[model samples]
Target: MSHVSRSAAVPPDDLSGPLTLDDLENRADKAYARHMETYTAVTVLHRVHMDHAVWNDTASDTLGLAREMVTAYRDVTRKEWYEAYIAWATAAGFEIPADMVNDGTDIPTGAADDPPDHPVY
Candidate 1:
């Protein structure tokens, strides 16, 4: 199992205190960056699992399950990231821009392309 430590990615201390528009904007940027970083990492890991499964017959089930988990986690992370941004914006008394919100209705759920017979490991 691979672990990614995020202990150093702590939020800025100014969030608990008086915040200017600039502070709010900076927070939003950091949140977005973190979300993107997670998304990219998950995507890479999922691809790795899928590729390994395709090439190695013995570990297909395990890798498939791992890929499925990564997919689900990616979806949840995407949703939670958006929610966190909205919460931060609300706390900062800033209006959430319409483009920033993705309710996931229009996005692919990542499971649609999975093979039907692969059992979870």
Candidate 2:
């Protein structure tokens, strides 16, 4: 990985100059995080805000699974960070997708799955 959590999501402090093999792994980890974040964001948009029932429900079903499946690679902190970020962004007037739409049944444990990974990467 890109030494992401190892250095709290960044290259090591010692590597201040050009990119070398020593920092390659860290860079890769950073790339992984970036891609994963982008993917989750898109999936959220389509799977939540967009009407999935209009389609065959196959894509939405798969996207739902993908959303939960990718969380395995992230640490606990990263997972909480993402959730908090969503709330913050929404409060900041940024349109964000909810986990569920038109559903008012709030189960206390709805979001209590094993989010040990960033989102289950």
Compare the candidates by TM-score and give the number of the best one. Answer: 1
- Model 2: residue 76 alpha-carbon error in angstroms: 8.7
Root-mean-square deviation (CA) per prediction: 11.7, 14.5
Local distance difference test, per candidate? 0.53, 0.43
TM-score quality measure for candidate 2: 0.27
Candidate 2 off by > 4 Å: 1-53, 75-121
Instruction: Give the per-residue Cα lDDT of candidate 2 at 43.
Output: 51
Q: Assess the local accuracy of residue 117 in candidate 1 as a C-alpha lDDT between 0 and 100.
A: 31
Error of 1 at 115 (Å): 22
Candidate 1 segments exceeding 4 Å error: 1-34, 46-54, 101-121
lDDT of 1 by residue, 46-87 (tens): 566656534556566666676677567656655655655665
